[model samples]
Target: MEVTSPPPSLLLSDSDLEDCYDIIDPPLTTSNDGSTVSEDIHKSMDEFDRLINLDRARRKMALLNEETEKEEEKK
Candidate 1:
């Protein structure tokens, strides 16, 4: 059987590597169907913020309840 050589990237020079960036890391662009992409991203961000705030509030309430319990125990 014949031996095949390695791919072009393995043999690339520094300048060649720089020029190959388009192939390596292509540009990211949302499709132009509608405002759905931006709206979806915004919706996701809002949901994430809401969840984070909810968690923080729960933790604060728990701490407050613990303090109240300790104060009652001391009385």
Candidate 2:
């Protein structure tokens, strides 16, 4: 039987490895369209703020209703 060597595994050079970044790192902030990155960020932030405000509320008698954190609906 002829002896054959195993295929060489692909390995990066030391410099290449040093230049590589963590795989879990978020990708560069970018916009696929012509809009700028900052503009995209602002747009997303505005939408988030709107959604957050929807569930937000203030109690005038918070001092009286200090028993529970969530307000229950009167069924």
lDDT of 2 at 3: 100
lDDT of 2 by residue, 1-75 (tens): 999776656667776665674344524557566675667888999999987776453343564466444444332
Query: In model 2, which regions exceed 4 Å deviation?
Result: 1-29, 57-75
lDDT of 1 by residue, 1-75 (tens): 999999976798887878798578754446575555556788789999999999999999999999999999999
TM-score of every model?
Answer: 0.54, 0.33
Q: Residue 13: error of model 2 in Å?
A: 48
Computed on alpha carbons, the lDDT of every model, listed in order, comes to 0.83, 0.63
Cα RMSD (angstroms) for every candidate in the order listed: 6.8, 9.9
Looking at candidate 1, the ten consecutive residues that score lowest on lDDT are 27-36
> Using lDDT as the measure, which candidate wins?
1
Residue 56 in candidate 1, Cα distance off native in Å: 0.4
